[model samples]
Target chain A: MKPILEIQDLSVEVESKKVLHHVNLSIQKGEVHALMGRNGSGKTSLSYTLMGHPKYRVTSGRILLDGEDLAGMSPSDRAKRRLFLAFQNPVAVPGVTIASFLRTSIRSVRGDEVPAKEVRKLIREELAGLGISETFMSRFVNDGLSGGEKKRLETLQLRLLQPKVAILDETDSGLDVDALKAVTSRIESLRSPDRSFLLITHYQRMLEAIRPDVVHILMDGTIVKTGDASLAKEIDEQGFQSIHEASAQL
Target chain B: MSPYSTTTRSTRKNRIESLPIPSRKDENYRFTSLSNFNLQQLNPSIAHPPKTVEPAPEGFQLAACTYPGGLAIALESSSHEGLHLSPFEDAPEAIFQKHRAAFDLPQALDADLFANLSAGRCENELLIHVTEGKKITQPLFLRNFFPSTDQAFYSRTLIILEANAELELAQEFVWDGIESLIQPFACGLTQIVLGPGATLRFSTVQNWNPNTEHFSRTYSVLQEGSQLTLNEVHLGGLKNQTRHLTHFEGRNSQSLHTVTALAQNSQQMDFWIDAVHQGVGSRSDVEVRSIAQDKGQIVFNGKIRIEPTAPQTAAYQKNPCLILSEGAVIRTLPKLEIQTDDVQCAHGASISSVDEDQLYYLASRGIPENTARTMLIEAFKAPGLRGVSNPFTKSWLSKNLALTEEEQ
Candidate 1:
């Protein structure tokens, strides 16, 4: 079985500041990987760079999705290739209804128009699955939505788009325990032998709920340590300082 | 000779001379060169008047009030009653004279050669009267056709609504395919009076022939407690200039103005919007969006003014331009003038190319780069186009902005 995504020596720079040094990580098909890091540790930068954010320049290295070079592809193209980034702060596109936006996205990604009735049915099912009401589908995307609602909306898109590899940026933030549970269950349901996830987060609470197959501690742009899901529990109990000390000894 | 032409040419010189250019210092003309266009060159000429009065084109219809008498009587009475009942005809001549003076009417008039075929010809003007407490169910469609390249023609429209009346009007401009370039000018002054509690939705589609140069001016006045929404679409032209002005004169009046200009392949468009909040508690919102490609040039200027007496007035103006080609030029000026401390006024102007992140986001979704750029541009203009009330017009605009299958 081939890896779903591979990041080889990915060095990223933003605004002339080196945010990600020589970093490397990979996720095999159907695996859930957790990228844990402190504030300003380049976890989000790495995700954005992989998603081809204009500001996050890949100073050096390559990003491959299913053996296809994704360094120069656009976010939309990346999205078509089954790549999704549930932004920590989703942009508010005023005057665009959620239904219309999703319809456009589906058409652009699939290169074919989905009948309105069918799309509506699909959206309704996806919204229900994410614990969102049908009324939410008529409102503008991310406009005036509560933080939790926005996160669920992202999950709704994940379910609708069914991207092969989803890089969720801090989706656990701002979600209540119930919302977190729902989100975790949705992520768990999406887990399969062919689909993969690169969950970038700072807290271990979410990981405890949706246990990942592998946990990588990212610090200063590089993945300093990789281990089984126990690594998350160790970081939760001992904090990152102990990990830094242990790495120094190693 | 038609009465209009006989009187038009003889009085043309006097009218041009008597017309007053409101001083550039005037609050309305401030920040705009009101007299930049040379009006003297626009001499009234009837030598090549339209040879025939062509029938209305396809996809358009016109209907007027049905009187007990024959069509002639109905037409005559309608024209007489419309012209006389117009509040604009009763407005202080000083205001009309001011606009006439500042802008060269004849020169700015469309010079399309096809207009000559219908020269001295007059189409039956549709008279719409919304009585107090009356609401119109069907949108009135006014379509004008200039079928010949041999001459110039003129069309006049008058719309009046009584107090508490609600109406929606859609006006479309279409030119026949002329073998030669057409220079036609349509002088339209649509006067809408919202009696206290009245509301109106007015939309215009200016899709002239690509070989034609078109000019038009639309002025609207809102009475106290009345509301107005004006949507303008510009899709075709060699050289097109349009001026849309809205005045909120009654206390608590409100106005929303939106303009979308899509220029491609060396087309030049100048779109100007002027909104005046003159009554206390009056509010105005203006938005202009333009997409220019292939060395196209688009000029967009939006102004909002809050008078001193209009305390608690709120006004906002936004002009954003998307340039798809390196050589395309977009000049945007968004201005706000507030004389009352209690008023809220804000203005923003931006000229930017496509966003890389947005592009990448779309491309990664399997959409190519060019298709992504086109989609982003459409998204950028969608906000302004959403206000269009006519479904056909909205779909037309969508088709114009959609990415081709090959491109996708």
Candidate 2:
């Protein structure tokens, strides 16, 4: 059982200031890992670095996807290698329609053009599952969409792209209960033998439904605790401060 | 039988002869240089028509005296009743003589010296007139295929749309391998008269090879309640200068001017657009989007004027230029002159490279760098191109855009 996605001693910096420090994390194939962190805890920094965002500099350490190093590779090349990132704040490209962008991404990743008819059908079915109307397919990519709608649209991409490893950064935030449920069910549906996921979130509400196989608490740019699902529930009840105090006392 | 008559041609030719060659001192000539194009090399005030027509040439389908393909290919119009085609000599008296000052070339030509040169030297030009109340559904396409660029030439087109008449006019220029054959310059003038409540959608694609310098002028006057939409697409030219003027003369009339410029390699593009609101409650909107790559140079001069008596006038002008590389130059000026106290007017101009966030976002979605670049450029230009209501013209632009992408 080899780890499908691994980040070894990873540190990330943005604009000459270090935001992440020596973070070690790995998710084996078919396993779901939840990264819990407070604000400024560098959760997003780690995820973006993994996706090869040009703005985030990987100062040290290596990001491995299926035993291959991802550093120096472009974001698009990483995407072609089946590594996907669900942006927390999705970019709004005003003129690109959702369906066209999706089809283009599919063609770029799959190395084959998907017929327009098939693309429309898939978008219709996926959007329906997320309770979003098919009209969104005609709209610009995430342009003026509600926060909840942007999250669901991202989840839709997550499924359609069928990446080997998916890193979802704060995807569950801003989602109402029904939307959260829809997203959890979609996450469940995506459960497969070879796929892996790293879900980044702070609260335990999302984990209650998706039920992560492992939960890690990241604070001040480094992972300080790695535990089972019960640990997430304990932190949710006791809050992160008590654990911080307990760890400091150790 | 020529309605234009000999007197008017000589009168314009005299104007050209008297006016010294335009220089940087002329405000309208602004950033354009008088030396690079070498307009002086041309016969200062004469239009030289083709000596021989070589069966539509090697590539393009030459616009014949009459055509199943000439007008049909350019305008993409199916109707024929409202169609009028002539070689200047046979223009009708009522159309040519009735609106003596009604056409806009007279007033617009004063802005530049070359325009006067073109008018003075023009010969055997085409004059088109659309009758009142007839909706010409078929588009009118003027496919100008220069038989040979051995000498300098200038052509003229006069269009009059009567009240309630409708037409979509398109112009496409093609001279692929004839660049070296081009001597000094080639020019054309199109004057339009939009009758009260008439509607016209005009589009132009300027693609001239590197050898020929090109200049074009379009001046249109709209009557009361008339509607006008004009799209100027500049894609290829060695040195190109186009001046467009739209006068909103009628009360309650609306006009939109959209321009798209693509200047690549060492080519130069200068575009001047003016929107004049004279009628009460008239409104106008002007927008330009340009892309300059390699050593291409581009200039956009846009102005909106609200007359003293035209109250409640609303006007806006926006020009955005995208620079793709070093040595690319862009100069833009957006001006609003409002003599009326009660007016809403605003203008903006900016030159920038492709947004990094936009580039990264597309790239992260698995789009290759080349594809992303092409996509961004197309998207940046689409909002303006979508204003093109004529199906034929829009399709032609889309096909040409793809052709440009492949050329890159």
Candidate 3:
């Protein structure tokens, strides 16, 4: 089957400095792919480029979602196409409440006004499943939230949005053990034939919870190796240095 | 008949004639100039009675209504106990003698020409009084109607709350017609006095025509254990200048002043606020929030003073402003003159544009760029507008906030 999302030789630049050079990747339907890299391996750069962040310039190649070129589309447009990015660090909006923000986003994405009561009920249910307090509905978005709470909120959005392709950029970094279990369980439950996920992380703990169909090792803005889940175990036993030495020999 | 005697009126007119016209060179008028106002339009006359009127909000009684030419009429001798309104010319002799100073205008014409101009041209006024220990259940509402004319209007108001009394009051300006060919100028003074252990919540909203000019002054005095809350919203006018002064006279008194304004087009708004702590253990809080678009300009000068005799006082001032357009300007000066070592005083001011990262975050959530910008601006204004004391006024502000389009 054709891939659900495709990145073709995407060379990205930020502030006129080349960040990602000639990168290519793809995720088929229902498959979870793990992209592992060391620090400064351009994992975030790839995620931002896919999401069409204004700062990340696409110097070459194109990102296609469902065979549609996302070249000149805005982030909002990409979001309408069921593309989601779980930010590693969410920005704080001081006076915008979480409930209002969620309602607005749902309405915007669907291009219609969902009934307030129905939206409220959906939000309450998702929040309860995530173990977040109801009082968080009134608090400002991400303001004064602990790192764990921020991740949980992001997971709640992921469930509500139910995007076709989700880029989880280091979502496991700040979560505690219990929260990690809960988040991974939700991600596992969300797995289906129509959904795809690109789980980006630096470690193998998250990979252990939800096994990936394939794993790719990213080094210096390029993917060096693509193998089954065993590649992650190999990297965990040795380090990226061993992989770098092996790739250099090729 | 006018409340002021002839001799007093003549002296005020003489002062208005003798004082030099304010120029931009003056420090107080540095950012503002009188060139936008037509000084020759000062013929104060009585307003023609309106053919119809808008009813007051539920749970509120119309205390008084003023027309374009400074004519104030008592609207309702309310059935609510302890509520009263009297024309300034017809106040009871004893009550008049007791609180006469609260209605007088400024003596320093050189420092306050506009106030003196209002005082010199004043025709009629209103006095709102609550008797001692009377807790008014219903809020008293005051309405001012501005007629479509080229003439300038002036008015005076005095409010007195006896010891242990409680009152809630609101005032709003209403334009008489849908449109006007000429812009009318408005000048008015309002003074409030709270007796020992008294409480008062006063709200005022000014949404005038964009071409109109307005000058307003409010001076309040708080006695022992008294509490005063003042909420003001300004969303209109061409060249608007307002002054607010609060005197914390008696021990343990408290006051809160909140102001929110929106300036669009070429509108210019100047606000001066002062809080003087004179009694021991008094507390005061002053907050101002404003948004400017197009070439709109806003100036806020806030001062807090703690006297040596007033030990252990707590005073705070905060002013936050947003400039939506590159040409828009916000100039704020927060001053603290603290004489006592035991007092706690703090002030802060911030000016910024819409945050880019915040916008991107919202946009990523599927909200359109325009919708995200409006949402952020609304959130920035929520905390300030939430301080509005009157429900009707609050509703009006909310409705107009959306309708007031950004001037291109």
Candidate 4:
């Protein structure tokens, strides 16, 4: 089957500085791909470039979703095409409540096929499933929320949106051990044959729970290593330094 | 005859004559100027014809209604006892005495030029009084109508609640004539007195014609253990200036003041709030939010003072503004004065255009860019209306804010 998402030699720049150089990747339907990279390795640049952030310039290459070019599409338009990104640091909106935000996003993506009243009901249930208080629905979006709480709210959006290609950017960085387990469990529950996920992180801890089918190591704006799930275990045991040595020899 | 119409009028007119034209050089008027308003050419005696008063809505008992520049005053009959509402000209001697006392409280009338102008040439006055220890279940409604004409209009109102009394008031201003062809000016004053342990929820909605210039002053005095919440919304007028002053007079009194202004086109709006804490353990919260589009301009000046006598007082003042267009401007000035050592007082102001990151966040969730901008702009003003305690006031403001019924 054709890949659900493809990056054709994507080279990206930020403020006229090249961050990602001729990078290429592909993810088939119903597959989990883990992109591991150290700090300053352009992990976030790829995610932002995919979402059409104005600050991140795409110097070259193409991003395809089911064989369709996504270049020049607004983030909202890309979202309607079933692309979602969970940010490492979510922005806080002081007066917009979580329920209101989710409802609006759902309506925008779903195009009013789902009634607002029904969407509200679903939001309440999802919030409760995450062990968040019902009153959390009334609080401002991510305002005054703890790091763990922000991650949970992002997961809540993922469940509601059910996007075709979901990118998780450092979602496990701020979480505690217990929170990591709970969040990964939620992510594992949403796995299906029709959805694809790209989990981006530097640690193998989260990979142990979600168990990606394929793993890629990015270093200095290039993917130097690609292998099966065993590659992630090998890096976890010997650390990234071993991979650095092996890739240098390649 | 009332002394306010006879003796006070002559004195105020003299004061006005001596007062120089307010220029941008003055501290209070530094961000604004009155030169383009053409105050000298406008006539103050062009009266509006009388208008018929509509019946009161359910859950409200109308006390009285009056057209500002008209010669008629319509009094609605109410079956509720201990509640008195009437025109100032027809009020009994006792009510008149209370009005006189209320009108004397030190407020913006002390030095504000527009306030003095309103007091000197008020065309009519409304008086609302509730007996001591009486809690009126139904709110009192007052509506003031003005004709669309190239003239000046002035009005005044006085509200008095006796000890332990409770009342909610929703006051609205409406233009009653055809679409105006010429500029019009209006000046109004409202004085409120809350006795010991009394509570008052007051809201004022001003949506005058686009060709109108409005100056409104509301002064409130809170006594021992009394509570006051004031919500004001400004959405119209070519040039508008609003002054709100609340004095905490007795121990443990509390006050909350919220002001919201939305300006588009070439409209100019100035909102000023002053809260004086003179009583021990008193508290005050003042918030002002405004959004300006096109060439619109908005100015907010908020001040809170905690006197030596006001030990253990807590006060906060915040002003947040949004400028949606390149030509739009917003100026916010917050001042706090604390003479007491144990008092807690703080003030802050923030001015910015629509936040790009916030818009991107919403847009990333599938909301279009235009819709996201609108949503963020509306959300910025939600804090100003969150503290409203009166349902009628909340509903009135939500309607003007274009909030859906589900959102409210």
Residues B1-408, candidate 3: write the lDDT tens digits. Answer: 345546445667777777777676664622456774556766775666556767766656677778766554555545666766776776767677787666566442235777677666776677788889999867777888777754567877888898999988878876765677777788888878899999998877787777778888787889999999887788878878898888899999998888888888999998988899999999998888889999999989889999998999999998899999999989898889999889999999999999988887887778888989988998877765445556655655555555222111
Worst 10 residues of 2 chain B by lDDT: B67-76
What would the per-residue lDDT of candidate 4 be over residues A1-250, giving only the tens digit for each residue? 8899999999999899999999999999999999998899899889988988888888889999989999899999999999999988899998888878888899999876778678878877787778788788888899999999999999999989989999999999999999998899988888999999999988899998999999999988889899998898888888789888888998
- Candidate 1 lDDT (Cα, whole model)? 0.67
Candidate 2 structure quality by residue, lDDT tens digits, A1-250: 6688988998889999899989899899999899997888888888878878788998899988899999899989999988888988988887677777888888898665466457667767888888888777778888999999899988998888888998888888999989899998997799897888888998898888877999999888988999999989988888899878766776
Counting only residues 3 or more apart in sequence or on different chains, how many pairs clash (N, Cα, C under 3 Å) in candidate 1? 47
lDDT of 2 by residue, B161-251 (tens): 8899887777677553543544546677788888999988877777666655788887788889888888877886678888888888889
> How far out, in Å, is residue A71 in model 2?
2.1
Candidate 4, position B330, lDDT:
89
Worst 10 residues of 4 chain A by lDDT: A111-120
What's the distance in Å from true for residue B406, model 2? 16
Model 3's chain B yields a TM-score of 0.91
lDDT value, candidate 2, whole model = 0.76
What's the CA error at residue A213 for candidate 4, in Å?
A: 1.1
DockQ of each: 0.38, 0.51, 0.55, 0.76
* Candidate 1 C-alpha lDDT tens digits along B1-408: 123334433344344355454453432322223344444433223333233433322322233221111011112223322222222223334333433321122233233221221122223223345556777644555555555443343444445566787766666666666666435444343445566888888777777777555655565667889988777778876777666667788899998877888888878787777777789899888888888899788887777878777898888888887888998888877767777788888888888888665565445445567765666676687766556665655554455545222111
**Residue runs of model 2 more than 4 Å from their true location after superposition:** A112-118, A244-250, B36-40, B44-79, B179-182, B403-408
Winner by TM-score: 4
What is the overall TM-score of model 3 with all chains considered together?
0.93
lDDT of each prediction vs. the true structure? 0.67, 0.76, 0.82, 0.82
